[model samples]
Target: MKAEKKPIVSCKGITKVFGKDELAVHALRSIDLDIIEGDFATLAGPSGSGKTTLLNMIGALDHPTSGQVLIDGQPLSGMSKSQLSDLRLNKIGFIFQAYNLVPVLSARENVEFVLRLLKVEANERRTRADAALAEVGLRGLENRRPSALSGGQQQRVAIARALVARPRIVLADEPTANLDSTTTGELVDLMYRLNQESGTTFLIGTHDPRVMEHSKRHIEMTDGQIESDIRA
Candidate 1:
């Protein structure tokens, strides 16, 4: 097999502490991580093991108490909130356990939301939203509202929404939790194909065995520290 490419993201000696002094909680110990572009990697650990904390820091949703996070060689520490939001909007796609779609909006409209935020032309947004829905196998269902779609379909729409902006990184947090085994497999396969076709980097935080088995790289954490990093 070919060697992995240079890293698009690097985190060095990352540390996150909650509260302060005597009541402090060390959510994440010193951590060093490198994620290459197009890498489909999973962060696996039990609850409170710092997997989520690390992911949050990488996504710029939270800051570390010490150390630094770099995306495409740009340090995150000095970025303003607006700059961080701009980075997230342009470079990161997020998928959560909950299919957080608006009940009143159709799937197409939901996907169009991000493009709207970016001030994309209405016609172009419509075209891209439809294409994204079709990419996720939700073409005809694009007219349906979240309430009208099944759990799996709703998640697929959520995925379409995440990808509509064509962000560089996709951060998924327990995306399969609400899915059945079959649907879980389908979703994972879809994401894998997307990674191959679009070179979109995936950083998933999950405890599911299926996720661990399917990912190209697996990083295991324990007690707020990474125990192992392996590539298949």
Candidate 2:
């Protein structure tokens, strides 16, 4: 890392445990990680490892039992509930394996959901949603609903929704898990292009070798601990 580059996501001595003592499950150990601006990084591990836990911590969806998470160099530990919500709204984008689109909403509507949450004017919302869907190669399909689209298309809609607000960082979890190889390849290519061309920081969590190989930084985890962290 260059001295001038600032970390967008920083985890210092982070740990997460579920339950107490005998029934306890350690989801993460004292992990230290930093994702700088414009990084395309991945967390790779089997189901039981701490990859998802760490991602949740970074996303502010879950709090760590110990230590600190800083977004844009601001510590999350001291933020109030509303403050955290605002931070997530303005600074982060999230994509899930299930392509969590509302079944009844059209692609454009789904994409516009974020902007609407921000209370953007209707005209601008429509314009931005159209542009975002087009950027994901879904130009003419904006009116289609989730059930009418294929898995990849649905995922693309989800991506469009996530990116419509222009968040500085994107956090995707097992984004290719539900797609076929061809679809996965296509989606990966699209995300790679977005990460490169848009300069949005991407931190993905997956066990797929394909995802790991495409990432510029790969971190492997095992039993709630980081096994290896390497930059390509």
Candidate 3:
């Protein structure tokens, strides 16, 4: 029998509230979830259903108003701001709804941005960035700027940037939101392949059916609570 995988991230009774009583927004309410190792999971919900809020908390970009989040067995509540930053830099990769590439940089340079943040030497950064871009099927386009690339290609560059650092878990917030049906399908296949090939953990936030269909796990949220969680 195969050994059981450990949870990469675990949340307990999570609640995130913005502002104070009488003028407050409850983004998450009593959320208890775990993202297992090497899993491809999608958080499915409509707008204001708290998918992005939960993703943000899991990515360590923000803290929960109440409850505890543990990433790789380290609790977020007890960590300092700088510690959180380091955790994000070291353990997590992010692909935003809008491809967050710097317009001024070439595709290779954009992919190299993450490595540069870690103070990697210029030579090794170039090599890994090239490999990442090639892996994402953007070989000859390495020198192209974001403005010169199509939306799908731009998103590929973003994916290259995200994976170049070989993070423990990749957090995608509506990765297919900006893509067309065809591109969405293509991107989904690429992500699924990458997950299987590299055994990288993926936790995506999306309402798109196409995006959710390929995931190994599906979690639907409504009114700041999980409506259902099914693993296949």
Candidate 4:
């Protein structure tokens, strides 16, 4: 049999500078990074190290000042804003520290929102939303609103929303920042299970030791540049 090929995400000579010439703040400087599909990786850095800037570029939330970013061989520069939005909707999942759930929407509804946006059939949307909630251990609390749910449960709902579409990549920024250690561990374990079983790749940006411990590869940044990339 032929060897299995690695799916690639590459950033070539990427640079991002804010402000004008003399007062400019260089957030990322000529970053050359590659993350293969099915990889579990963490971006570890101190504040102002441009870890989030690099992630934002990868997530299509921001453009690089110079160079290029390629996802699955598609150049980001080749995409229009609408095309990027479509790509994000269909191919990327975002998990943020704040959970970002709709206050008025129930757990199931929040997950259903993404399905609806994807134009999933109404009936199938409900079914898939329920299943996604169940996968995140919120099966019995589907009717609860964000205010009624605990922080961990709310984050689980956010995770469900992210995973319901089965995106190829998950970009998580400080996802466990608000959780206790126990809940953080549970969340990490769940993500690992999903990654292993579904082959979903995770690219997490975190400063937490817990995240580093669970990551297969950890890339550390400092002063807006990659200081080291380590595989554990």
Q: Candidate 3 — which residues are off by over 4 angstroms?
A: none
- Range of the 10 consecutive residues with the lowest summed lDDT in candidate 3: 77-86
- Give the range where candidate 4 is weakest over 10 consecutive residues by summed lDDT: 2-11
Using lDDT as the measure, name the better of candidate 1 and candidate 2: 2
**Steric clash pairs (candidate 4):** none
Ranking by TM-score: 3, 2, 4, 1
Q: How far in Å is the alpha carbon of 108 misplaced in model 1?
A: 0.8
lDDT of 1 by residue, 1-232 (tens): 9985877779999999999999999999999999999899999999999988998999999999999999888899989999999988988888989989988899999999999989999999999999999999987887898999999999999889889898878999999999999999999999888988898899999988987787999999998899999988
Cα lDDT of model 3 by residue, 1-232, tens digit:
9999889999999999999989999999999999999999999988999999999999999999999999999999988889998899899999999998999999999999999998899999999999999999999999999999999999999988988999999999999999999999999999999999999899999989998889899999998999999997
What's model 3's TM-score?
0.97
Candidate 4 achieves a global lDDT of 0.91
Candidate 2 lands at a TM-score of 0.97
Clash pairs, candidate 3, are: none
TM-score of each: 0.95, 0.97, 0.97, 0.96
